[model samples]
Every structure is written in C-alpha cells, then in structure tokens.
Target chain A: MSERILSVLVEDKPGVLARVALTISRRGFNINSLSVGPTNIEGRSKMTIVTELESVEQVKKQLNKLVNVIKIVELDPDNTIESEVLLMKVSINKETQTSVIEKANLSGAKSVDVGQDYAVFELTGTSKELIKFEKLLKPYGIIEMIRGGRIAIQTKL
Target chain B: MTKEKLSGAELIVRTLEHLNVSTVFGVPGGAILPAYDPLYDSPIRHILARHEQGAGHMAEGYAQATGDVGVVIATSGPGATNLITSLNNALMDSTPLLAITGQVASDFIGNDAFQEAYTVGLTISATKHNYLITNAEEIPQVLLEAKHIATTGRPGPVLVDIPKDILNEKANWTEPKLEDLPGYKPTLEANPKMIQQAVELIKNAKKPILYVGGGIIHSKANKELFELSTKYNIPVVTTLMGRGAFPDGNELCIGMPGMHGNYTATTSIQKSDLLIALGVRFDDRVTANPKFFAQKAKVIHADIDPAEIGKVREPEVPIVGDAKSVINGLIEKLGDSEIDTNSWLNEIKDMKENYPLNYNQEEKGPLKVPYVLEELQKMSEEDSIVVSGVGQHQMWISLHWKFKSPNTWLNSGGLGTMGYALPAAIGAKAAFPDKQILALDGDGCFQMTCQELITASTENIPLKIVVFNNGNHGMVRQWQKIFYNHRFSASELTHHTPDYVALAEAMGATGLRMVEKSDVKRVFEEMFKTNDRPVLVDCVVDPDDMVFPMVKAGGSNDEVILNEDDLKNI
Candidate 1:
C-alpha cells in the first residue's frame, strides 16, 4: 500500500477526533500517523493524518459524511509543508561523546541536556530529515526516541 | 423570544414540542427519569415500550411508515446499549430516527458508575451523527441539530446522549441558532450536465429498467417515479426496501430484484441494456455478484449520498443528488424526447407471463406462509401497513403482497433484524391509527422481540400479528437442505415450546392458531374483524416449505432457482 497524507479540518469538540479516526480505521485503513492541532479559525481544529490506503478518495467521501469534518485536502509531498518535533536521548561515553555532539550539531539538533553517559537532543524538521538524523543517532546507541506525528499543510492553498 | 429558566429535561421536551414531535416511543429508567417527569406534563405522548430495542425499532417503523422523523428515548448503560441493534437497522435503511438516551451523571461518567456505559463511544459508528450533552445550555442546540441531522439529506439515526446531572441542571431556554454545518451539506440537486447525459442514455437505450430503492420513499418521490416509469413505458424493479415505492400491481412494475427476488425481475435486470438506478445502492442481495450483475446494462446511478454512489459498482453516469430532485431534473431535461420501447415492453410482458412468483398449497396438507400472506393481503385495506420479521416470512410477504402505495410496506431491509415486525407495527399503528397495521413474522423471528406484544396490549395499540409457525428457522433449514445435504443442525426449534397461542394470551392479546390450509382465509378474516385489541394468529405451516425464486448467495442474479426442476438442472 502507498502512504497518503490528508489534512482534515474538523470542529474542535470532544470525541470528534475519535469519530474521525474510528470512521477511517473501521474501514480497515491502517493509520500510519496522525497529528491534531488548533486552527486559526475559532472552534475548529486541523488534523493531519498519514494513512496507508488503497483509495484515499473513498476515505474522503466517508469522512465527509461525519458532521464535524469541515474540509479534507490531500497533501502532495512535493508541494506540501510537513514537519514534526523529535526528542531523542542517545548513549554516549567519553570517547564517542565528541563525535556524537558534532554529528548532532550538523543535523540541526540542539543539546537539550547532557549527562555523564547520555545526551538529550531535540530537533524539528521534515520527516525525511528526522529519519536521517535518527539514523545518525542510531550509531550512538539511542537510549530512547519520541517524535510527534507528522503535521502537514498544502503550501499552495 | 423570552428567555425562561428550564431544566435540561424540560428543554428537551419543549424543543421536541417546538419541532412538532407529537409522539415518542421509549422506556424510562433511572438516568432518564427526569425527562419522563417533563414528558408526563407535555403535549408529546410517550408510548412506553417493554424494552429499549423495541422502542428503537418502533421509532424506525414510525419513520418508515409516515415519512416523518421518529423519536426513541432510553436511560444509560443497558438501555442505551440495547438500542444498538435498532440504531444499526436505521443506519442501514437510511431511516430518519432520533435516539435520545440518558447518560450517567457527568461526574461519574468515566468512573463506570452504577448502570453506566459509554453510550456515545458505543454508538458513534452506528449512528449517522451523535452528541454527548454534558452542559445544560447545550441541550437546545444539540437536540435541534440532532433532529436536523437525522431528518435532512440522506436521513439516518442521530443520537443525543444527555448526562443525568445535565438533565437536572437549570438553563435559560431560548431558540438557539441552528449552526451552519459546512461538513454536512448533502447535494440535493442533480448537475445539469449529468442530467443531460442521463437523458441521452435514456434516448439511446432500447431495454431500460428503473431500478428503484428506498430513497424514493424517504424523499416522497413515488409520484415522480410513477410518472417517469409510465411516461417512458419503462419497467420497474424495486429493492426490498423499495417495496411499495412503486405500485406492485402496475403493469410496468416487475416485482423485487435480488436474492429470493422474482424470476422475471432478476432476469430482466440481468439482461437490461440500461439501468436508471434511483435511490438504490446495488446491494449484494439485489445484485448477487457485482461483476456479473446487469452485464449488459449501462448504469445511471442517482443517490443523495456521494459515498454510496460508487461504493459497490461504479456507474457510467453517477448523479449525486436527492432522488426526487434528480428525477425532476431528468424529467425537465427529457422534454418530450420519447422514443419507442414497445418491443422491450413486449419482451418484459412475455417474461412476466412465463415466470410468475407462485407457491403450491395442497388442500389436504398444512398451510403455507405464502397462502397466509395472500389471504392477509386480500382481507386487509389497500392503505394497510405490512411489516415483516426477517427470514422466510419476510421473503414470502415481499413476493406475495401486492403493494399499491409508498410507505405502506415496512421491514428490516438492510440489517434484516428479526422481531422487527411487532414493535414496528405498533409504531406504525400509533402513527396512523386509522390504518390497519399487520405484523407478518416467522416462528423463529417472532420469538426474538415477542416481549413487545405486552407494550402494544397495554398502550391500546391494535395490531394484527401473524406468526408463520413453521417449527424452524425456515431460511436456515432451506439452506441446510440445499447446501448441506439436508443436515438440519440447530435449525429446528426443539419442542417449539411456550405455545404461541398461550404466550399471546399471557401478553394481553387475542390468540388464535390455524393449522389447516382451508382455515387460512377464515382465520385471517376473524383476526381482521377483531380490531379493538392486538391479535396474534399463530399459523402452523409446513416446516419444509421454502422461499423460491432463489439466487444462491454470492451466485449470479441470472441463475435464479425457480423450483425443484431448476434445482435438478443445477
């Protein structure tokens, strides 16, 4: 299956997210990732969902049936602005600490905290950049990793 | 409008009154007691159902019969959960039903308090739209919105779950502004370009069929459908849900199409050159195998919901709009461009004559379900409402009964929920007190929601219920007989205890049992004559009797099994 990103505008109400997610996942579409945030429009929230779907058109039509969903737009990876925040703690010793710090600096990661054997770095970038940076940290023995799901917006409209 | 302090329960009752909801079917419980208190003093009459499921189905029945929004109320937890079946039934059928359920106290909602359940979470997927009301002030707006959503475009069940505390809390009552829901606007008018395309297809098609669905009844477009069918001399085949949408007695009407559908209707649809599908989702029951369904037909599908337009089979011309408006669009565009289809009509007439829906009733043997239905149809008024339970009896009624008007036939079409007939009949009777409401049920189906008979008896709602007691799940047994080498495993009712006649008497309804074939007409006549109270006639029919004109599940619609000869050939 191919991954498709959908930006849905819905009413900012309790259980509205559940309704949308349930409507999608119930139809057997696996949700790869989803992020929700408040929109500039009052009483409305925007949800960026990354799903592995055979036909996103069918899902859009189903989503449109929900009373809370105001709008749905597919985001083209080529013309869409997508980003997420990643917080990673990497294991480091005296010998590898310098190299790890240098690599993290090159990847635009800020050292949020430093311990004797561990370094906590925070980064914000496109999912592609984050994946690349994650690979860099993997060599340093990642202690833990957490990334906010991707949020996208169509750049043109 | 003057603002007045009102409790959430009061607000609900007042809003219902404001919306012209004269009747509600429900059973009160702990959480919903406050609403009942207000209801006791309101103009809206509440019919107390024995169970919440019965209430929901009754509401659905009322909606289907009258083309009006039906309301059902129940308390939280078990009460709300029980309504799930009915909610799903309404959802599948596109019935305009509003289910108002009481929730646990707002403070104890997540605590899993006594008799508390996550009603909204449970019903979110089942309902068209649902609201959980915790704030007293939100009651007016949410209720109004719930009603609007349930009754408007692509009508379906909408639920409003009110917390007990919210129901008790006081709030100022004023007519809240109906929010403009940008997400929920249904396309009601057909695109002009698409209408022109449909017209062109109609002009070119030699063999065309108006494949009608329940949407016609929901949209009150029976007149439009009739006009179009007659004006074009096109034959019509209605789905189970579209039973009475077109008069069954009309020459152009070729009965139902699908599994257990008429031979002529099924074959005609399979062989048609063009199908002008209106308000119908080519359901699997209608088009057994989508790939092979209407192999020759170029489909022009019209429906209010965009999702259903291409959910099954992609049409050559998909028109997303209300059935009535779409038909009007087609009529406006056609503008006296009628070509001749006499040859096609003659072919259909030959098909109808050669393959008519029939059943054998031996004079010396036990009564048959079809015979009972035939007699009932003959004895009942033309405007009488016929509701059936699922299985053998349902198929028999759909095939045998000659429906002459829209909204006169009601059953659990989509979900095929058994035990739907009695309560739905009660609901229909309540809505149209002047019309005769008949509940035709199978022995297996009748027992599921038979408890609702008490509600009908107590509420003084008279209904004529005919239980086709064949001593088994007739449809299942038929399948076993055909597919499983006659191995009737758990299909037969062991002993068939609780004697339906005695049970009927215990429930305060007149009980009658007919075992002989000759007594079919007399028993029906006697039952119809007694109209003061609910009457339950247990018809003892041959258990081996099966519904014919059967298209084996997942089989092609063209391969209909007409009788023993057809089965032997297969």
Candidate 2:
C-alpha cells in the first residue's frame, strides 16, 4: 500500500496533541511521522502527519471529526516539496580521503567538519536520495548517523 | 452602554475571572498563543509548567487541597494529550477541576489540519462534562457550565476545547449571571421516609456504625456528623478520603476502614448490626468484599449521587440528597433519642487496645514514619491540614496522624496518584496561608512531582513536607512480599535518590534529613520552629517495613493481614 501524508492545522493549546493522538489510536491508525510547529498566523499551528492506512477516504473522514482541526489536506508527493536531512559521521584514513571526497561531491554532499578520527558529512534531499547516498558511502566506515525525519511544505500555486 | 468585540481567548479569561478563578496552572503552545497573549496582561496568574502533564497534576493538587475547582490550560495536540493522566486522576478522586485546551481552527475542522484533536469526545468518560466550542460567543456560557458541572453533584473534572480560529475571531461576549443551567438540577433534599427509617434503625440497633466518606467534607457536614454521632453515641468508621471527617481523638471514632485500614476499624465495621453509611459510596477499597462487608448489618446508605446508593451493596434505606442536608434531617428526627452505646464503644476500645498500630524497631534505627506523623500532630494546631500522596506513607499518615477538623487531611485516595503530595501541599498552603499544611510523602511518590518544590519556593508557601524515604514503591513491594511470595519483580527500585537537603537548599528552602530514630524529635523541632520557608524532612525509614492490617482486594474486610501474633489471635 502507498503511504499517505496529511497536513492538519489546529489551534495551539495543551492537551490537544493527546486528544488527537488518543483519537487516532482509538481509531486504530498507526501514525508514521507526525511533526507539529507554529504557523505564520499568531495563534495557529500546523501538524504534518504521515500514516499508512487502508483507504485515504476513511482517514479523511476520521480527520474531519477532530474538534480542534481547522483544515485537513491530503498532499500528493509529486506536487509537494519534501526534504529530510541526514547528518552522518564516518571514520576515514588519509589514504581514503581523496576517494571519499570524490564520492561525497558526486552525491551533492559537503564535508561539514573533521574530528580526531572521523569526518562529518551533511546531506539534505528526499528520503530516497539520502538512502542512495548512504549506500554509495557504505564502503567508507560510517561511525554514527543522525537523520531528521521528513518535513514537507507545499509548493506555491 | 457601548460594547466591543473580544476574541474567544479573551472571553475565556473574563469567564474564568467571573467564576472567581484567580490562579491557573498551564503551559503555552502554538495552539494557545492567542490565550497567552491576553493572559499576559490579565489579573489571573498562570503558572507555567515544565511539562503539560505537570500542569494537569498541579491543577489536580490545587483542587484537591482547596476544595475549590482547579483550572489547567494547554495548547492543542500533545499539550492536550499530556493532561489525560491528570484528568483521570481528578475523575477517580472526584476532585473538581476545569481543563481548557486550544484546538485547531474551525475552518480546518476536518481537513487533516495541524494539531487538530477531538478532545471533548476523548475526555467525556474521564470528565463530568466536556465542551468543544466552535463559536467565540459560546466561551462564557461554556466556562460557566463547566464550573457549575464541576463543583456540583459529585464534583469531578471537566474539559473545555476551543478551536484556535474561534479564540482569535472577534465576537461580542457577556458574562452569564444565572447559576442555573437548563436540564441540570442537583438534588439537595433527603427522602423523608428513608431518613426516618434510617433514624429508627440507628436507635434500635444494638451495634450501630456510622461510615463516612469524602462527601461529608464536601458537604461541610462535620458538625452535623459529630452532633449525630455524639447524640446517638454511635462509633464512626471513615474511608481514606474521609480521614478527618470526625475528630481524631473522639471516643467513638474507630479509624479509617479500607484496604490498608486499621484492624479495629475493619473489625468494628464487620461487627456492626446496623451500618449507617453517610455520604459514602462504600468504594471497593473501603468495603473490600461487597457481599461480606458489614455482613450482619442492615445498611442505610445516604449519598448525593443516586447511582452510588446501590452501586455496591443494596442499602436497606437509601436517601438521595446532599449529605449535610440528609444528616441534618436525621438529627432533627432523632431529637434526644438518648441512644447509649457504652457497650459498643467499650468493644471498639478493646479492639483498638488489642490491634493497635505497632511496628517493631530498635531505639536507634532509622526514623519511623508513624513517629514523624505523631510529632507533626503534636506540633501543628488542631485545624492544621495534612496532604499526602498515594503509597505506604499516605496510609501511614491516615492511620497515625490526628485531625481535629474536617477537610484537614487531603489525599489522592481513590486515584492513588504518586507525585501528588508536594503540589497538593502548595495548593493547601495557598488556600489557607495562615494555617499549617503538611505533606506526607514516600520517596517513590515524592520524586514524581518534586519539581513543585520550585513552585513552593517561588510562591514562598511555608508548607512542610515529610518524606518517608524508603527508597522503593513500599506499598507495591509490601504486597509482593506478602501475596506474591516475595518475587519482588518490578517492586524493587534501587536508584541514587537526590540529596533532599541539597535539593531544598538549591530550591531556596530548608531541608533536614533524619537517618537515626533518635534525631527525629530534634529535626521535627527545627522544622516546626521555621516559619520563613518551606521545610523538607527526608526521614529514612526501614525498607523492609510493611503497612500491616491490609485486606486484599476481593477479600472480606475481616480477612486482614495483621502482625503474625495478632493474626493468631484473630
């Protein structure tokens, strides 16, 4: 089944998240990535939630029942600008530095900094792009990796 | 007169002020920014909590302590969700609280809008009433209704969910004056025939017992209860919530009756021929086993909630009304019945003598909780209030502490909430600044909401906290030791606890630790002498100690586990 992304706008207040999460839980919906942040409006905030559901229509109907929900939009990935960031630190010797730099540059990555025994690379792109970059760099000993979950914003009309 | 439009957020503040809510505990978030902006300049004081869950507990503590409605505000989504535990806590304890949360804008109601939640539906079962306001104009009426529902008729928590758009939108607002609401009427009068029948049963019964619950204090019927108990010479048994309903040292007072109840109290309840249960629901913890509780007795149950009248064991005479009013009626009907219970009182006195709360300890061992409680009772005035969190310490306080007046012992009885003591102590201190307030807390319970010590310090409320640092969930551990064959699974909690003295000093308060039993008196003396800042006495207790005379759930009240020797006699 294809993954669904839902954008929900709500008033900022305490206990609202609990109410929504509990509602979704009670409805047996498993949320994938739920991100909430303040909106441009002073008193409003928005939540971008992604979930795998049986039917998009059923999810839409359930979203409508939320008391604090002001708007709900099911986004199509093709029309939306979605990006995720990956911060990976890898161990590299002086001999392999040239090859690693070449590979990193090929993936549109930047060498952010170098530690005593490791070098950190910053990568920002779609989830698929980040995964592909990780696969190419797997030969180089990767020590630690931190990935920011997907955050999406719709493109202008 | 000319009027101006106000946002729903502004309306909520005005309504709260109209309802006489001077203080609220909450955390600000995106969904509730509008309300915070208005609140920034308002007369109401909002305490910002570190977590949304903390806000809920703080409100619960405040309400439980003051007997006034506690109010908590949180923004949409997670903020609202975090309050579930607190709401459930209030619901179980029957504490009156008003929880307000901001929701997503109305226009985005169903379109998968950000932070949108169906809070009202989620909270319906936990709250007495819940409202989701789509219109800004309805804020005033909704708040008033919430307060009214919360304070009247078996007081409990209520929730008000307002959409962000509604809060930001301009609307004409007016405070509603009438206290009455349509289709909402609470019973205040007792059933006359039932009251008469109860009086008759009380007068003729050879062994009669008066079982009181939190309802007596809620109804402010202590004087009436005392008068009736004294007039009829009937002994009284109180539930944990009803600890201070009767004078502690009263001759006819048996003790608290329930799961961890005193053996004398439970025995008195079992032996009574007539049970005049007033303002009590006979909760499972109190009754133990419904079928066998007060087995030989005919029950005359009087309560404000009609549903609770026959919810457990059917009452022979059920009077549905305010406890104070029904009790008053009972007193009026029994004008000088001159009912003597010297023999019954003697029997109770014998039971108390035989099964008194006793714990074995060396003279120089760690401080005993009961000793600290006894000292606190001796130090404070008769009207001083004692608040406690749920655990072994709470039961210890209920069993040992002496209360001279009603509503003097506030506890999270039904809810059994840990981390309730410190906040509750602050609330009680705030409610009655001049009166002494003490919090009896266990180590496990105290750490849960110890952050409230910051509130106590900042607010400068001189509340005393006596921490029974047993270093484990004592009650649960005790149960495992007894009933579970000492498997000790998750009950064993061994962690490096914070240095309470350093914690108190850091929080700008006085802290004392009593490791040796001999030092208890001196430490208590210092605590009682200090009047400037709140004091924390970390009294290290015996880890192996257990709260005895506990009746297992589903067991008869008579089936209590006393010290081995006492069990042999029984």
Candidate 3:
C-alpha cells in the first residue's frame, strides 16, 4: 500500500463530518491523518485526509456518493506544497544545553517556552525535514510532543 | 407566490400531496400525533400497520412494485428504532423509500426524554440521505429534497426526522422551490466512447451473456433490454432482483443466476466470453469466489451508481448512467450489427433442456413447494404480482414461476429479511387494488410478521397469501444437512404453536389448508376465487425438501449441484 491524499469540499452542516468519516472507515480504509477547516465560502468546508490505500479510485467514488460532498480532488505528492507543525518539550542541562541549542538553531526551531531544566520548541517544515529535526532532538530526552497532521494544496490548482 | 400560514405538520401533508403521494403506511404515537391530526382531514389514504417495521417494509414493497417513492411514518424511540431493519433492507436492495419519524421536542432532545431517540444518528448509514428538521420552516424544502434524493440517482431509502416542537410550530409557507444541489446530480447519460467500446466487444464476443439486475426495473428499461437481447441474440441471465426484468419464457432468457440460481443460467455465465452487465452489481451471491467467476470473460459494466461500477470485479468498460439510457446508447451505437454465435447458442440450448428446474412429488406424501408454485403460476394471470418472504419458498418461486413482465416479482433479495412478504404484499395490494397480488411465504418466515395479516384484513386489501409450511427454517436446515452433517440446531419450527389456519381466521381473513399433493391446484383455484377479502392458505410441505441447482456459498459457479443426486456425489 502507498500513501494517498484527498482534498474534499463538503457542506458545513451538522453531522456531515461524521457521515464522511463513517463512510470511509466502514469501507475498511484506515485513515492516517485528517484535518478540517472552513473554506472561503460561508457554507462550505474543506477536509484534507491522508490514507494508506491500495487504490484511491474506489474511495473517491464512494465519497462522491455522499449528498453533502461538493467535490473531491487528489493532490499529487510531487506537485503539491505540504507542511506540518511540531510542538515539543525537551529536558536539558548544562552539558546538553549547548548541543541542543546548536541543533535547534541549525534546524531553525523557535524556543517557545522555557523552564528551569526544560525547554519547549516549535518547529515547522516539510515532513522530511521535520523527521530529521526530530531525530536530532531525541538525545535531549523529549518530555512531550505533538505533531500536526499534514495539510496540502496543489501548487497549480 | 402567495404565502399561506401553516404548521410544520400541515406543510408536510401539503408537500406529500404536491408530490402526488396518494397512499402511505404508518403508525401513530404521542410525538407524531400533530402530523396525524393534519392527516385526518387529508385525502391521502393511510394504512395503520401493526408495527413500524411492517410500515417500512410495506413502503419498500410499494416502491419495488410501482417504481414510485414509497412513504412511511412512525413516532419516536421504539417506533423509529424499529424501522432500522426495513431501512437497511431498502438500502441493500436500492429501493426508493421515504421514512418520516417524529422526534422529541427540540428542547427535550438530548435530554433522554421519554419516547425520544437519536433517530438520525441510528439511521445515517442505512439511508441514501437523511435530515433532522429542527426548524419548522425547513419542512417543505427538506421533504421535497428527501423525496428527490430517495427517488433519483440510485434510488434508495431516505429518512427525515422532525422534532415534535417543529411539527407544532407555525411557519409562513409559499410554493416550494427545489433547491439546486451541486453534489447531488446523477449521471443519466452514458459516455459515448464507452458505448462504442462496448459495442465493439459485443460484436466480437462469441458467448455473450446479458447480466441484468434490478436497475432495469428501477429505470423502466425492460423494453430496451428486451430489444437489445433479442436483436443481438445474446443470452440473458438475471440476478435475483432482476427476476421480472426479462420474460422467463423468452428463448434468449436463461433465468435467475445466484447461489440458488438455475443450472443453465449459472453455468452459461461461467462459460461466457463477454458479459454485457447492465444495472447489476456482481453480488457475492451471484459471483461466488469472484476470482474464478467468468475468469475468461471481459465485462462491460453499466450502473447508475458510480460506486457499483468496479466494486466487485473490475470491468473492461465502465459506463456510469441510468440503465435505460445506457441500453439506448448501446442500441443506437450497434445499429443492425449482427453477432454470429451459433455454437454458443446451441450449447446454452442443450444446458437449458438437460437441466430444467425439477422436483419429484411422491404418489402419497406432503405437497412440494415447487409444485405449489407451478400451480400458482398456471392459475395466475401474466400481470399478477408475486411477493415472497425469504426462504425455501422464495427460491422455489424464483426458480419455477414464469415471469413475463416487469415489477411482477418482489422479494428481499439482499437483506433476506424473513417477515418481508406479508407486509410487502399488503403494500403491493395497496398500490394495485385490482391486480392479483400473492405472497409466497415460508413457515418460519410467516411466523416473523404474521400479525400483519390483520392490517391486510382490516384494510380490505384482498391479498392472497400462501404459507409453505415445512415446519422448519428450511434454508438453514438445508445448509446444516449439507455442511454441518445434519445437526438441526434449533431450525425446526414444525412442532406447532399457533395453527396457521386458526391464526388467519383470528386475523379476520379466510383460511385454507392443503396437505395432500392432489389438492395443490384446486386449493390455489379456490384461493384465487375469493377476490373481495384477504385469503391465507397454509400449505403443509415436506420438511426434507431442499432448494437445489445450488452453488455452495463462495464456491465456483461451475460447481453447481443440480439436485440431491449431485449432493450425494459431493
């Protein structure tokens, strides 16, 4: 199975999201990540879903059957701009502070919250860059971390 | 447009009248009493069902018979929850049905009020579309939309949940306008490129089978289907839902193909070179072990629902459109092109003659269900409607009855709900009061919803029902005998509780019992003679009789067991 992303536009109505999620899960497709937000239109919302599936054609056809769904388009990974945000809190001390600071600076991470022996950093980048940055901070002892799901828009409409 | 002040309940009745709904099936309760008040003065005929499930199935039966949107209503909590099975049945079969239910007052919702349930949440998956109407003003448009969504596109069930407060609230109503929905346009025209490609395949196919399904009847395309089949000389094999879509006696017709399908129809599909599948989903019952079904054949699949096009087995050419339009496109594209397949036709003819559906009746024993169906088939007119409950009796009717027109055969094919026949027969009789509507039910199936016989009698529907009483869930018993080494395991129902004839009499209908083989024809003749009131005939059949020409579930279609002799071989 390969990773697939779909951008769906649906009416902003009660239980619409439940309907979409139920339709997908009941069809036996495991969703890796999903993010929903309002669009420019007042009564319409956009959903970006990431899934690992054998084929996306069947999923598209099934989703199209929903009466609330306005349109669905697939985003090509090669032709799309994708990013995610990560919030992480790491423990540090005198010995490790220098190395952690150096790694954070190198990766353009911003220090958001600071404590006596711990520091919280916010990072934003492509999924590949975030993975590498995350690896660099693993030695510093991560206390907490939250990774936002991927959101994408086609570069060429 | 002049605005008329009306309550939400009155708006609903007016909207249904505007949609030309003359009859409805339902039950009344506290939450829905407001709507019933308006219904009391309306010209629409309402049949009070014994149960909410009965009402829902009756609507499904009406829709299946007339190709019209069937409407049903019920109250909150238990009444609404009871409609779940019927909604799922209509969803599975893609029947056009509308279910309206009353919810607790808007303020009382989510408080776990008495007789209140999350009707919309429970029915979301079972309906093609659904709405929870909390505002009184939303009634007119929402009802119109619900009917449109239920009747158009793929034709499935839709539900509308109206809060009690909304029904009682007054709203200013004007002539309603159907709002345009961007997401809900159904593709009615087939792609020309796909049609041309299908025609090319059809012209070259040596052994082609028209795999037809219920979409033909839903789209009213039987005439086009018949013309295409006879003109191209292609053999037609109908699925369970497609029983009456093609004339059974036609030379090109091979009969129903599925687990309990005819030997010729099932095998011909296995050996065909090309499948011109129209309005059919290759269901598991029909295409057991899809990997081995029609392995060498190229399928040209057409359906109104895009999701069904490549759902089971991938097709060479996929055309998403209504069946009638798709068939018309194919006919136009293949203008007078003749296909030569004399060898394949001869092979099919041989199979048909050698393996006709057969059952033996002992010189002195219980009546066979097939013999009973044959007698009914002979005694009934071509236009008579036959509805069946799910079991051995249903299979016997599908296998034996010679259906000559569309909408004459109705059954719960996908859901296999046992209690479907009696109530559905009531619905069909309501739709066509003058037509001969027969309900062929099994002993176990009859017991499930037999109480609906009172609804038929009270409404004076004049439906003729036959219960094939083998005293067991015959299909389950057949499976146990074949696969489980005859461990009966609670399938028996013959020990007798309430006698069927007595129950029929208590329900205010005429009752008759047929036990001897010689009484089958005469009993059916007598049943048909009584046209003024509902009649129920209890036919005591042999418990050991089984439905054959069967492909073991999920088995290859090529491995069909034609009879008990074949079973012995297995």
TM-score of each model, paired residue for residue: 0.97, 0.76, 0.98
**Alpha-carbon runs more than 4 Å astray in model 2:** A1-157, B110-114, B179-182, B564-570
Single out the weakest 10-residue window by summed lDDT for candidate 2 chain B: B177-186
Candidate rank order under DockQ: 1, 3, 2
Q: Model 1 misses residue B141 by how many Å? A: 2.0
What's the CA error at residue A98 for candidate 3, in Å?
5.0
**Candidate 1 has which clashing residue pairs, if any?**
none
Q: Among these predicted structures, which one has the highest DockQ?
A: 1
Chain B TM-score by candidate, in order shown? 0.98, 0.95, 0.99
Clashing pairs in 3: none
lDDT of 3 by residue, B294-372 (tens): 9889999999999998899899999999999999999999998998878899999999889888889886977888887
Between candidates 1 and 2, which one is better according to lDDT?
1
True contacts kept of each: 0.83, 0.00, 0.63
State the displacement of the C-alpha of residue B185, model 1, in Å, after optimal TM-score superposition: 1.4
| Residue B458 local lDDT, model 3 | 93
Query: What is candidate 1's lDDT per residue for B1-570, written digit by digit as tens?
Result: 767899999999999998899999998999998999989999898999989999999999999988899999999999999999999999999999999999989999899899899999999999999999878998888888898999999999999999999999999998867888878888898899999999999999999999999999999999999989888788999999999899988999998988999999999998899999999999999999898899999999999999998898888999999999999998888878785889988998998889887888888888888877777777789888899899988988999899999999999999999889988999999999989998989888888999999999999998999888888999999999888989999988832576998999999999998989778778888898888889999888899888998998888887999986777776
lDDT of 2 at A155: 79
**DockQ of predicted model 3:** 0.79
Candidate 1 to truth, TM: 0.97
